[model samples]
Structure formats: C-alpha cells, structure tokens
Target: MRSLFFFAPLLRPHVKRFALALLLALVTLVAGTALLGVSGWFLTATALAGAVSFNLFAPSATVRGLSFIRILARYFEKLVGHNATLKLLSTIRQWLFGALFPRLPLPDRSLRHGDLVSRLTADVDALDEIVLLAIGPLIAALVLGGAMTAILFALLPEAGWIYLSSLLAAAIALPALLIGVTRGTGAALVEAAASLRAHVLDAIAGQDDIVLFGRKDHTAIRFAEAGETLSRLRRRQAFATSLAAAAVTALTGLAFLATLYFGLSAFQAGTLSGPILAGLVFGVMGSFEATNAIIRSVGKLGEASASAERLHAIATLPSAIREPLRPVALPEGTGIAFEGVSFAYPDGETVLDGIDLTIAPGEHIAIGGPSGAGKSTLLALLLRLRDPQHGRIAIAGADIRDVGLADLHARVALLSQDSPVFFDTVRNNLSLARPEATDAELFAALKTARLDDTIRALPRGLDTVIGETGTTLSTGQLRRLCLARTLLAPAAIVALDEPTAGLDRETELAFLNDLPQALANRTVILVTHAALPPELALRTLTLAHGKLEATV
Candidate 1:
C-alpha cells in the first residue's frame, strides 16, 4: 500500500485517459451482454414461428444489427484500454530515470553493471503487466457483476442470489490467499536480482585476472549458483501466481453450475421463460470472466509494490554534498586557504586533524605524505567531492560552500591520481577537457604528454580505439593521456594526485620535461611523495599520521 500510494503522482498526467478507458470498458460490457441476450431471444422466436409454418415472417435482420454493435464496442474498448496503458508506461520510464540522476555522484559504489541495467530495463518490463493486472480488471469485475445481478433479480431472484453469492466468495478469497502465498517473495527476489547483477559484472571485470590466476572454473560455479538461486525464486513466484489463477477459475466454474441447476427448476415452475433461462447463463459467464480479471489484478499489485519500494529507496538517498541554496559567486584570483581543517569518516576516527594551509594563485605546491596520511582526502575536499567534517576551506577568501557547486567545479580541474582512461579514441579522450579543441591543439597536448610518437606509430594515429579501460595501452601511456586531457582544460586551478605513480624512469623524465609547458600560468596543487622537479617554482607540505606541518 505504501509503495502503490507513492506512485500515484507518476500517473497524474494519464488519469483522464485511464478514466476514459474504464468508461469504454463499461460500455463494452453492457453492449456485449445485452447483444448476447437479444440475439438468443431473436433466434428462439424465429425457430418457434417457423415450427408453426410462419418462421419466414420472423425478423432475422434484428439479430444481425445487434451482432455488429457487439463487434464495434469490443474493438473501440480494447483500443482505448491499450492506448491509455501505453501512455502510463512512458511516464513511468521517465520517472525511474529522473529519480536516479541526482544520486549518481556518490552512488552505491557497490553497484555493478548488471544491477543498474536490470533496474533500468527488466524492472520496467514487470510494471507493464501491473497496470492492467491490478486496477483495470478490478473495475471491470464490479461493473459486470452488478449488471448481471440486476438482470438475474428480475428473472428469478433465488437463482440470481445463489450465483452472485458464490462469485463474491471467489473475489474475497482470491486476493487474501494470494497475499498469504507471496508475502515474503518480493524482498527476496529483489535481493537475488541485485546479487546476480553483481556476480556477472565481477566475473567480466576480472576476466584478465581470472585467466592468469586459473580461477575461471571458480567464477563459473559462483555465477551458476547465483543464476540457479534467482531461477528458484522466479519459479516460486510463478507457482503462487498460477495457483491463485487456478483457484479463481475453479470457483467461477462452480458458480456456473449452481446457476444452471437452479435455473432449470425455476423454468419448470413457470417462474422463468425459456429465453430468460438462456439469458441467465449468458449473463453468468460474462460476469465471472470479469470477476476473474479482478482476482488476477491482486497478484500484480505485489509486483508493483515491490518495484515502487526499490525505486523509492534510490530517490530518497540523502545527497552526499549539500550546496548553498543562495550560492555566492566565485571570486577573482584563485588563492586557497585551509583554515584549521579537520576531518574523519562517518564513524569519527580522524583522517586529517588540525590541518591548515594557504596557496596563492599561480604558486606550484607539492604535497608529500606517507600512505594513509590524508593526502588524497585533502585533495578531495579541495575539489569539493566531500566537505571537511570540521573547520572551513575557503577559495579566494570565500567559503567553498557559499559558492555554487558548478562554479566551484569549473574553477578547479581535477587530474585524479588514478587518472582513469576511457576506452575511446586518442582524439576523443583528449577532447573531453575542451570539446571545441582543434586537431592541431590535440596534437600539441599529445606531444607535451609524450604520446605523440605512440599516436603517430599507430595504424590510424589518433583514431586508434583503445580497448576497455585502456587495456590496449600501457600504464605509462594511460597516465600521459590523462595528463594531456587536464592540459586542455580551461581552469586556473588544477589538482594532480600522484600523476607519476606508475611511470617508468624514462616516462617519468618525459612527463616532467613537458610538465612546465603543460602546467604554465596555472595555480597547481600536486599530490606526490617525491619532490617537485627542477623545472618549476615550488613549495612543499608534508602530512604524517593524520597531521599536517609545513616543510618548505
């Protein structure tokens, strides 16, 4: 109920169409049942008249006219129902995508490829059936049930009473039995789906390592287990769904028998005509099918409720970083000050304590720290990925929180130590920093990053398609490309984290050789364990055991 209730706003735009479709279905039921009753009477009257040598005088054209009405009603009613459902699907898809966008930055890092894909695609597929499976049939059953009872009451009240009572019993039992059966399956299915996604992604991402370590068989076993587990869940859900459907069918069949047994007795007592007797059976069949539709709808609500809960969980994640509601503009000149800044993760064991620092615009500073000394954490705060738990970090004498997030990011271009290389062409990867950069500019950055020779030697030069995560490129080449990308960015403030971490001696010298030309005129903050090379004016700061002290 909670999840289904939350989903109402998503359906607001299509409510009019939904209501129209329901009305059309009502018109269809009334017209269809009435046509069946009228045609039966017309046939019987024509037959009796003919037996008296006057059948040729009966109006056969009346039955033909009513048959056409049934055809038109069904066709248009189905059209309206399908059209309304299609519109609702489009709205639901938009909501799912829109709800997840704001949470992407600090997204569940634990999230894997398959899990995201399933939520975006497969979960949506489940919902398409839910619309009709829940509401449409419920309304259809009520309308048809009441209509049949009204007709039956006029013919023989006892027969109508017996049949309607049984129909009502099925309606009440169908949902209650289903709720008991599928009570615990939804949460389990959701977890199983997520786990399968994670396992598949893990196997693919580690394919290279798996082959080298001779662990392919191990991964296969794990994947098989995950697949089998999810399969069992699906089978159980399906079994429960089938069982409920079967129960409804059996109950409706009994109602039909009860109507027939009692109707025959009424006809012998002259309480019901021959045409009315046949009409009662026709009405019961029409009525029960509508009732059965309602029964199936109850099972569908479980699925919708489950999906809605998952989607809501994603939408409600507290934003990791909160920007100022009334954002201050970025000031001129890029000086930064870290004033008595102290930090820790959520549990509160310190990562950086009592840290303080300042750097003027265009001043190149290298921050050297032992491992786990808060070097990367400091840089992350400077880039505003996470704010300090205590103390203030001001940029150009204005607190970073006071500035709009977009403006702060635009002011600082982060060249992360991991310096991830996307598996795009050399030119395409380089152009991410400045999308309008020309071919000549790209070649210039390539030369400065020492990747010009490698690009030229390739068969397609800059158009080479580096495989996934730069698997086709060496570590040194990947780092140089990452540096080249940062060179093309238009920010005065650039922060580099261990840019030379995995480089060879020759590659290291080449990177430093072109470093000045690439880093010229910018306020650069370099995170490295070693000293800055001789080519740049520099200051040094050291952080050790979560404490910072100037060591220039």
Candidate 2:
C-alpha cells in the first residue's frame, strides 16, 4: 500500500502530458464511435431509400475526414503514452535506488546477481506497463463509456440501456475474476522468476567452484526446480487471464445478439427508424469495445502490485547501522577506544560481548585469536561495519556513532578477508580506493605491495583487463593488489585483515615489514593469527570468544 502511495507522486510531474494525451484519446474515441454509427446509418438509409443515399459523396467525404482526424489523434495518444511510461520508469527506479537502499543494511549479498539486475530492469518495465497502459486507458474507458451511453440513448433509449448493462457486467466481472487471480499469480510468478534468475546467475558465476567441489548435479537440480516453478506460475496466470477474456467475449456476443433481435422487433413495430436503429447498435457496441482495454489495464495492476511488494521488501529492512544526523569529527592521528562493546548478528548467538580496548594514536595494534573468536568482529566495530548493541566506540574523545558514516569511513580504511576484485583495468581497480589519485601515487603503493614489477610484465601493463574478480591474477596477487589500493588512501587509521593469511613465508614477511612504512603515521589495527612484527606493535592482545585479553 505504501508502494502504491509512493508511486502516485511520480505521476505529478508528467500530469500535463498525461492530460493532453487523455484528451487526444477522448477525441479519437468519439470520432471512432461516430464513424461506426455513420457507416451503419449509410447502409440503413440506402435500404430505406431503395436507391443511393441522398448526397452519398458528401456524407462519405465528411466521414472520411473524421476518420483521418481520429487516426492522427490515436497516433498522438500512443506517442505521448510511450514517453510518459519511460519517464515514469526512470523516476520510480531513481526512488527505489536512492530512497530505499540506504535504509536497508545488507551486510552480506542476499539477492542473486542477475535477479538484482532484473529488479532494476524487468520489474520496473512491468510496473511501467501498468502505470501508463493500464491506469491511463482505464480512465479513458470510463469517460468514453459514459459518452457512448449518452450517444446511444440519444438515438435509442432501450438499446442504450442494454449496451450499458452488458458493458458494465463484462467490465466489472471479467477483471474481478482475471485480475483477482492475476494479483496473486503475478506476485508468485515474479518471485519464481526472480528466484530462477538469481539461481541461474549464481550457478554460472560459481560454476568453477561448484565443479571443483563436485556439487554440479545438486546445483543443477535446484536450478531446474527454479525454472519449473516460474514456468508453472506463468502458465497458471495465462490460463486464468484467457478464461476471463473468454467470459468477456461471450458476454459481448450476447449483447450483440440482443441488439439484433430487439432492433428487428422495433423496426417491425414502426417505433424505430432503420437508420436510427443502426446508429444506436454500432455506436453503443463501439464504446463497449473498450472493455477489452479495461481488462488489459486492470490485469497489469496485479503484476505491478507484486513488483512493488518485492521492491518494498528490500527497501524496508531493519537497518543494522544508522548514521548520525549531525556528525562529530574524528581526532587527528586516530586513537581508538572500544568501551565494553557488545553485539551479535541478527538471529545469531553473541559474536562479541563485553569487549573493552584502546589503541593510542600511531600505535600498531595486532589482534590474534582462534577462528570465530571475534577478532574480525572487533575490527568490524572499529570500522562501524557492525554497530554495538551495548557500550560505545570512539575515535579519540568523540564516540564513533556520533560521526556520520561518510566522514568515519574516510578516516579509517579496512582490508577485509575477501580481497574482492572487479572485471576492469588494474588502474581503475586501485582507483576504487581513491578515484582522484595520481598515477605516481598509485605506482608508489603498488611498489610497496611488491606488485609493480608483476604489473609491468602484463600485456596491457597497468591498463590490463583483470577479468571478473581479477581472474587473470592468482589469489595471493589479488590480495596484494587490494592491499595496495587500500594502502594508497591517506586514512587516519589502516586496518588489515589477515594480510599474510595465505601468502608464503617470503612474500608474507616482505608485506608485513613494509606495512609499517606504508602506513607511516596512521594508527594500524592488524587482525592476524600469527605474531605480528614486534617492532610494529608496542602491545599485543588475544580474543577468545568475545573478550579481549592483553599479553606481555
């Protein structure tokens, strides 16, 4: 319901355009109905005269002119409608991205890659059809229906009553059944399709890993299930939509039969002129034809509702992290303090509890712990990736939560366990850390990571495409590259996660030894399993469960 309300404002800017287009549609509807009535009258009049209708050429020419005007108005309506849809889609997507995402804190990737893309494209497209095609036409149909009833009544009151009754029945009943079923099916179909997209994309993206792990068959089975689910939903929706259309078509036929039978009776009684009877039947039926458009318009709303729900689901998450409205500044040289901080991931046992620690400015703090001992969690708190449920963390004299994330993030740079890489040139990958960095500054950091020589040997050198996730580079090399990028930034605090976790003795030592020089005056927090360089850290601590224990 919020989603529907949110979208209402999107139409305001383009209201004028929609208004003009609707006017054009009304003009076209009137002209088309007039043509149908006039054509029928011409035949009936000829029959009555027992000769060519008086002034046949003049009537034909006038009818032709009206039709030509109607054709142009129809074209104009279509043109404006398309433009309005595109504009509405752009505006709505902008809202979904800008207003929604910040409130949703997805610490981990929840949506599948392709499904995420589909949300931006296919989902929006579905809603676009509903907003432009469905909403606009429904309004036009109601207006046209009233006008058509008036025209029919003016010619033949009984016939007008019959046509209006049939039209109302078809218009209400068909959509109530079709779109009623459509609302549930559209959401289910969209969910199944999104699941399918996400599943297939994950399969493809993780194909190598799956094959390596020998889980290909299991993955394949899940993927097939996803495909089948989507297909079944779509098939069910199609069947229901068709059934409603058939009902509408059947009613339409009954209305036409009634008009024919009654017209013959009225003519025989000499209560109705043949020409007037013809005009009433044609004009009334012509207006009722828009019932088809009404059903189509109404059907799409169901799909749009489903799409809106999906978007709202992601948008209205219980955000784990919140930014300050007015932020305080971090102190110079980054003294870090964690004051009895406690936290746990949502729906999980406590990951960190009663954690208290402090690191003076320019100090190298090496944290060591067994796997799942909350060493990483402590680092997370410092970076404010995960906020504390209890206590406070501070940068010098100010609480970390008091500072806005944008400012806080700029002060501290963290290199996590996963050294993620993009499918891009090496230069741009490094630039992700600092987009405005100079080539010389980038090269200097690469040199410190011992990657400068390796990059120089590449075919494209610094500009070489690394493929997605830097497939061209080995794992250790990717880590070094990421480290280099993070090192390039002039953050007040630099935190490295298991910097030497997978590297060999030689490379690991080289990196560890150079890290201090690379960081210079910045406070360093290193999360490692092994002993850190004694010269770098003045004090060492171990994390067991969630407590921080100091050791000599």
Candidate 3:
C-alpha cells in the first residue's frame, strides 16, 4: 500500500479531472437517493389523500426533477471518470518509459523479456483502478452514508444509530476484511499471470529448438501448468469477493428490519407520519448502493498494491554505471590507451588482468582469441558500458571516465557480436546510426559492407519493411545489414566484434580486404577469430588466460 503512494506526484497534473469526476459521482448518488425517497413519499401521500383536496404539484414535480438529475449525473460521471483515467494512464506510461531509459542493460538478468513486458503493460494498467474504482467509490460511499444517517436522525431519531452502525459495517468493515483475505491471492494471481505470459513467449521463441530436441510435449505441459495455477488463484480471489458481498447483503437486510421496527414503534406512539416513514425506509435501501461498488473494488485493491510494488522495485534499481559529476571534454585525437586495466565478474572470475596497451590515431588493430577470452569485455569497457575494476582507459590522453558517456559514445561506435537488425525498413535501420544521413551516404555504407546490390533488388528498396530480427533476410545478409549500420556512424573510431561471423570465406576475405579503404583515417579495433589477409597491413594481438600477447 505504501508502494502505491510512491507515484502520487504523477497524479498532480490530472487532479482537476479526477476531482470533477468525483463531484459528479457524488451528485449522481445524492440524486438517486433523493429520487427514491421523494417517489415513495409522493406515492404514499397520494394514496392517503384519495381525492381529498391534495396539492400534488410540488412533490410530483420534485420526483420527476430528481429522476432526470439522477440520469444525467450518472452519464456525465462515467464520461468524466473514464476520460480522466485514460489520460492518467497515458501519462503513467510515458513516465515509466522515461524512467526506464537511463537504466538500460539492466544488471539483473533474472527479469526475463516477457516478464518485463508484463510490468510495463499489465501492471501499469492495473493502477487505473486506484482512482476510478477504489478511491472514487469509497469517497462516494462515505459522503452518501453520512448524509443518509443525518436525515434519519433529524426525522426519526430512533433509527439513526441503527442506520449508522449498519452503514459503517457494510462500507468499512466488510471491505477491510475482504482486502485482508484476498491480499495474498491477489499477489499470487499477478505472478501467475506474468509466469503464464513468460511461458508462452519462451515457447514461441524456442519452438524450433524444442522440436529439434523432441521436447515439444514437455513445453506444452509446462504451459498448461502455468495456466492452471493462474486459473486456481483467480477462483480463490473471486470466492473471497463473493463472500464479502454476501455479508454486506445480509447486513443491509438486518439494518432495514431494525430501522423499520423502531419506525413502527414511533408511528404507533403518534410521533411519525406514514408518508415520512415510507420515504425514510426507501432512502435507507438506496443509501446502500454506494457499498456495492466499494465491495467490488476492494477485491482489486490487493492486486493494485502488488503491481505497485513490482513496478517500484524495477524503477528504483541502482544504475550499472554512473555518469561523472563534472565531465571533461574529449580531446582532439582518437589515440587509445588501456593502462593497467583489470576486471572480474561478480563471482570472482577474472577475465582481464593488468592489461596495458596503446594505439596511435588511425591504427587498425585486431585481437583474436578463443571464446570466453574477454574480447567483448574489452570493447564494453572502451564504450563505458561497464567501468573497469582498476586502472584507467583513455582516448587522446583524456580519461574516458572523466568525459560524458554520450560524448564518449558519439566518438566510438561499436558493432557488437549480437548487434541486431531491427524490425524496420532498411533505411530506418541505417538511420539509427545517423538519423540525418542522406540516401547516398546510406548506399555508400551498404556498398562498403557488400550488401548494396542485394538491397537494390528488393521490392521497395530502402522503403522495404523487414520482419522481426530480419527473418525475411538470410543470416549472412542480416549480419551485413547490421554491419552497414555500424559503418555508417560518424564516429572517429569503429569497433567490430565477430564481424565475419555468418559470412562465407570469400565474402569475409572481401570485406577484410575492403576494410582499410572503407574506414580511411578512422581507428579500428576488430575482435574475431578469422584469419586476416596478409596484405591488409593490420597489427594483431592474442588474448589467453586473462592476458594479452602480441602475435609473432
């Protein structure tokens, strides 16, 4: 519950809309109760008059007026309330995305892709009930219940205490009890639903592997288990809600009977009129309407609370890397230096140890090694994706840590081993590297990566929309497409990790042969196990056992 309050600041801008909705809702309930009371009074008095010189003008007009007001107020209340809730939801999504950007490359891998999607979509959606369902209805119940109690006191004091006690029990006690009973079930339901979604996504993503390994049946069984867990929790929560609602219904009946008993005693004592007694009894029935909504919303309160806690956990995680307090400007050259750099993972597995190296501006260097040699770790360090455990990495005599990450990244572009070809147009994918690049420049990069001719033959050329992960393209073509994007960046340095991964030997050699001309005057750091052509004039180094050694 306290976690839910963490987002209160986001509600400030939309408070007016919510407040107006609340006002209309209160008016709707008041008019409804008044309508019932007035109609009863008017009917009873008419029956008693029996054509005796009775003036039915005022009561009849009021009954008609209250009914009309009730209808209009209810309509506007729904309109305003839903509109405000949607706008609030939009703001929350924007805010969540904004909060999410700087925390990229989250350190916690326990949060699967599908689970993260659930938090961003479903969990954020559950918060809508905070205003429209829970808070609004609870306030309406309090105000209406209090007003009804006061009227009973003024007109028939004997029933006032009875009505107030029943109102408190129905409006406050039962709802509280419902929240307590369903709290754990509601939380379990959220987790169960998220787990089910994760299972479905995993199955879809790994269907090919599951089939190859003959584990399709196992996967299907797992999905069924997740579904069953979600269904059972939902049933449990529904049962709790129904029980509370039944309790409220029984209490309402008892309150009515007790109120009637006192009203009758007062009437027999000649203290109460028949018409007034009927009106009060009818109003008592109408006042309990507010509690119905309260009871329903109480069941969702626990779900909302759990969702809030989940969202808060993700948003508050400490960033993997922090920006410098007072950043220094990057110097003029691209000369790189790694001075006494050492790094180890959280489990104390050293990947790089006391590495020291330097390269002059415009140097083309290749580091070749077996897998798990920490070649990619070196690149990540250079890009400031992770800070080194010890020592400094400098470019042009400026410590990379002392410069702004954005500025440092702007100067050094990386094409990682797993660089993705987004589900978008070839033009849009290339534009990610340089949004303002002209079509001619885009074509130049593609041609350098040896992919221009293939793209030119596509149905829409640069306007073609590619499938997710570039499924429409061949593996080698997708790799080249990503390479084209990296080469298109306007950085002074280019870092390529396994650039020739999916290419044929002929294409790989051709790409390496064209590399020097394609990246003229820019420093290049290439990490791959591919053999370099002798004529390329590139310096080579090898990494083994947490150390770098120059190749003979």
Candidate 4:
C-alpha cells in the first residue's frame, strides 16, 4: 500500500487524461451491453409485429444507430486508453531516471548498475498495470454494473437483486480472494526477475574470467537455474490468475441463470412484457463483460505492488553528502585548504586521518601514495563526493559544504583512471563539459590533450561514433579522450587521478613533459605513483598509512 504512494505525484499531472480514458471505457462497455439488450428486445418485438401488422423501418433504424454508436464508442475508448497509457509510461521513465541519477555515487555497494537498470526498465514498466489494469477497470465495473442493476430493478425487482449480488461477488469479493491467493507471489516474482537480470549481466561481464577458469559450464548452469526459478513463480501466478478468472466467469453465468428464471416468472404473471423479459436476460449476460477487466486486474495488483516497492526503495535513498540550507557562492580564486580532514569508510577503517594541506592559486601539487593510502579519497573529498567524518575542506576560503553544489562542481574538474569514455561522437563526448562549446573549442581541447591527430585520422573525425565504452579507441586514446573531456571544462582547479596510467613509457613521458604547458595557470592536484619531472614546478606530497608527509 505504501509503495503505491510513490506514484502520487507522477500520476497527478495526468489525472485529467486518466479520467477521460476511464469515462470513455465506461461508455464503451455500457453502450455495448445496451446494444445487446436493445437488439434482443427489438428483434423479438419486430418478429411479433410482422405476424400482426408490420412496421420495420423504426426498429431497423434503432438497431443501426445502436450498432454505429457501439462501434464508435469502442474505437474511441481504445484510442484514448492507449494514448494515455503511452504518455504515462514516458513520464514514469523520465521521473525514475532523474531520481536515480544522483544516487549513482554510492560507494558502499548498496546498489548495482544491473539491478538499477532492471528497476528502471522492468519495474517501472510494471507500474502501468496500476493505471490500465487496476484503477481503470475498477471504475468501469462499478459504474456500469451499478447502473445496469438499477435499470433491471425498475423492470424486475428479483432479477435486479440477483444481478447486484453477483456483480458484488465478481467485482469486490472475487478480487479480494484473488489478491489473497497471490499476495506474496508478486514480491517473489519481482525479486526473481531482478536476480535473473543481475546474474545474466554478471555472466556477460565476467565471461573472460569464466572462460579462463573453466567455469563456463558452471555459469551457464547458474543462469539456467535463475531462469527456472523465474519460470516457476510465473507459473504459480498464472494459475492464480486463471483461477480468479474462472470464479468470475462462474459468478457471471449464475447471474444469467437467475435473471432468466426470474424473467420467466415475471412474464407469466404479466408483470413484464415479452420484449422486456428478453431484454433483462440479454442485459444480464452483456453486463458481465464490463467486469472482465476487474477479473484480469485483480491478479496484477500484486505484481504492481511489488514493482512499486522496489522502485520506492531506490527513489527515497538519502544523499551521501547533505547539501547546506543556504550555500555561499564560490569566490573567484582556485586556492584549496583542508583543515584537520579525517575520514573512514562505512566499515570503520580510517582512510585519511587529520590531514591538513593548502595550495595557492595557480599552483600545481603532485601527490604520491601506495595502494589504499587514500590518495583518491582526497580527490573525492575535494570534489565533495563524500563529506569527511571530521574537519572542513574549503575552496577559495569558503567551506565546500557551504558552496552551491553546481558552483563547486564547476570550479573543480577531475580526470580519474575510472572516468568513462562513452560510446558517442568524439565531439559529443567532449561537449559533456560544455554543451554549447563550438567546434573550435573542441579541437583546441583535443590538441591540448594531444588527441587531435587520432581524431583527424578517423573516418568522420569528431563525428565518428566510438563503440561501446570507447572500445573503438586504443587504450592510450581512451585515456587521452577522458583527459580532453576534463580539460574542456572551464574549471579553476583540476584533479588528475593517475592521469597517465596504462600508457606506454614514451607516451606517458611525452604527455607528462607537455602537461605543465597544457595546464598553465590552473591549480592542479596530480595523484600518481610516477616520479615528478625536473622541469615542472610542483610541490610534491606523499601519503602513507593514512598520514600525509611533504617532500621537497
């Protein structure tokens, strides 16, 4: 029930369309049942009149009018319902993606990319059932069924009671029974779907490792196991759905029998005319069609509930770094100061301890440390990706926590080893820094990062598409592409984390030799294990065992 609240705001703006669609559905179903009753009653009355004194024109016109109305009503009903459904689906996709974007930086392993993708695509898709299947059907069934019962009651009271009782059973009690039967199954199905998706992704991502370790067979078996588990859950859910449908059908059939029995008795007593008697019988049969959606939707409620719960869990995650209530504007300087900065992971291992450091505007500093010495953590903190457990980090004499997030990000740029090179046009990837950047600016950034030659050699130059994860580019090219993107930003401060990693000695040395000239006047923090070049004017610092030591 709580999970359904996640869609409150998402569905609010589209409520008008939803209401219109439901109205159209009710009209379509009601018109269909009325057409059936009218045809039955008219044909019987016309046949009787033909034997006495024929008047065919009026009855023929009425049947034609009802037929046309029925056809138009059904066509428009489908059009409106489908249009609203598609629009709602588009909005939900956008909303869910926006909500999940900022939460991607979770370093604590609380979320997985595969699972997130599943939630965004599969889980979000499941929510459509709430609108199309559940709510829309419930409204149509109640309105149409109630109105038909009232009409029957005016004509034949006993038949009306039977119709109302059976409707109540099908529309209300049967749905409850269906929901109870499939209550836990929905959650289980959702979990199984997510797990299957994760397992398939893991197998694909680790295919190389699996092949090398002779575990390919084992991986295949595990994937099959996941599929089998999903299959079994779906089978149980389908069975429950079928059972619910059977119950509704049986109830509807019983209502038809009761109406026929009562209609015959009323006709014999001269309380109801022959035409009206046939109308009541056919009306009861036709009225049950409106409840078809109710039967189908009852089973789906459980699945939608599970999807909602999964999506809500991700949407409500608290930010890792809390934003200030009133953030100060960043000053017009690049100097950074870390005052008694200390940090520890969620597992309580201290990564950085009381580290104090400062760099003046336009200064370049290189940091060196062994693995696990928290060198990269320093870059993360400086960028405000995570707040330190203690102490303050300030940029341009203002605490980062007190600076607007967008402003702080604009002032500092990071080119890390793990930065992604997306599968897109060369120009488009570089333009991520500044979308409005001109071609000349892109070329300039490319030249600065020494990647212009590679782009020029490509078939389409900047317009050429890079394959997935930039696999089309060489290792060195990919690295330079990421560097080019970072350098394209108009940031006052730049943090390069192992910037030249994975490059050959000559390429690495060449880039390092030209680094100072390329980044002239920018405050730089370079985290690397390489020895500093003699020509560059840099203050070098080494970190060991969670402590920083300066080396001249």
Best by TM-score: 4
Q: Note the Cα lDDT for every prediction shown.
A: 0.76, 0.78, 0.88, 0.85
lDDT of 4: 0.85
In terms of lDDT, the best-performing candidate is: 3
- Write down the worst ten-residue block by lDDT for model 4: 101-110
| Pairs with backbone N, CA or C atoms under 3 Å apart (clashes), candidate 1 | 50-55, 133-297
- Looking at candidate 3, what is the lDDT of residue 308? 89
Error of 2 at 156 (Å): 0.8
Taking all chains together, the TM-score of candidate 4 against the true structure is 0.90
Over 26-113, each residue of candidate 4 has an lDDT whose tens digit, in order, gives: 7777777878888788877877666458676776687788778778877886787788878888988898778766765755365677
Order the candidates by lDDT, highest first — what do you get?
3, 4, 2, 1
> Which is better, 2 or 4, measured by TM-score?
4
What TM-score against the true fold does each predicted structure earn? 0.76, 0.81, 0.88, 0.90
User: Which is the better candidate, 2 or 3, if ranked by lDDT?
Assistant: 3
lDDT of 3 by residue, 1-552 (tens): 888899898899999999999999889888998888888887888898864677888888998899889899899988988898889889888988887777876777689999999999999998984786888878988999898888888877767888888889989999998988999998898899999999988999998999999999999899999999999999999999999889888878876887788888888989888888888888888888889889999899999989988888888877877899999999899999999999998778999999998988999999999899999999999998888999999999999999999999999999866888888999999999999999999999999888999999999999899998898788778877887898888899999889888788887888788789878899999999899999989899998788999999
Candidate 2 displacement at residue 59 in angstroms: 4.8
Q: Write candidate 2's Cα lDDT for 1-552 as tens digits.
A: 357665787779978877877788778877887888888887788777866437688668868988998999999988987787778788888877886566544654566568777777777777775655665556666777787667657655676687678777777766776766788888888888778878877888899999999999999899889888988887887787777777777877766777767777888999778887787677766766667777767666677788887776666666667888777776665898888899887667797888888888898878888998888878788878788899999897789889888878888998876767899999999999989988898888898887998998999888999989788987778888998999877788988888777777767777778777777787989888765555664477888878888865
Model 2 lDDT on a 0 to 1 scale: 0.78
Clashing pairs in 3: none
lDDT of 4 at 300: 76
